[model samples]
Target: MPVCPYCQVEMDDDLDTCPNCGITMIYFFKCQRCGQEFATTGILKFCPLCDADLSEQMN
Candidate 1:
């Protein structure tokens, strides 16, 4: 479970937009294996760097 930084509302980890604030929540990610950083508009399933499955590794 993660909270929206802007509205402080509880939200699902896979959500890209805040239900309460109606704002798009872009996620910044870093690959665990390769240490590669990237940005996504929503939840991502894999790391662009090493093609690693990021469902479990991402926050």
Candidate 2:
């Protein structure tokens, strides 16, 4: 199960939007430098853990 970012409600993984808050589900970002993935609500230009530039990576 995944928690909604807006309401913090637990939801199924197959859903793309939260039922309670109506916010979009998590967006995954892969860090090219460290080969790690991050979950965010929107687009991120840099990795939070590695500080790598992620603008070139495909969403």
| Candidate 1 residue-wise lDDT, 1-59, digit = tens | 88888999999876889999998988888888888999888878888779887888664
Model 2 lDDT per residue over 1-59, tens place: 87876789997756778889898866888788999977887667789888898988743
> For all the candidates, what are their Cα RMSDs to the real structure?
2.0, 7.5
Q: Check candidate 2 and list the clashing pairs.
A: none
In order of appearance, the predictions have TM-scores of 0.70, 0.52
Off by over 4 Å in 1: none
Question: In terms of lDDT, which candidate is strongest?
Answer: 1
What is the clash count for each candidate, in the order shown?
A: 0, 0
Once model 2 is optimally superposed onto the true structure by TM-score, how far is the C-alpha of residue 6 displaced, in angstroms? 17
The Cα local distance difference test for each model comes to: 0.84, 0.79
Please report how far candidate 2 places residue 18 from its true position, in Å.
11
Task: Flag regions of model 2 displaced more than 4 Å.
Answer: 1-21
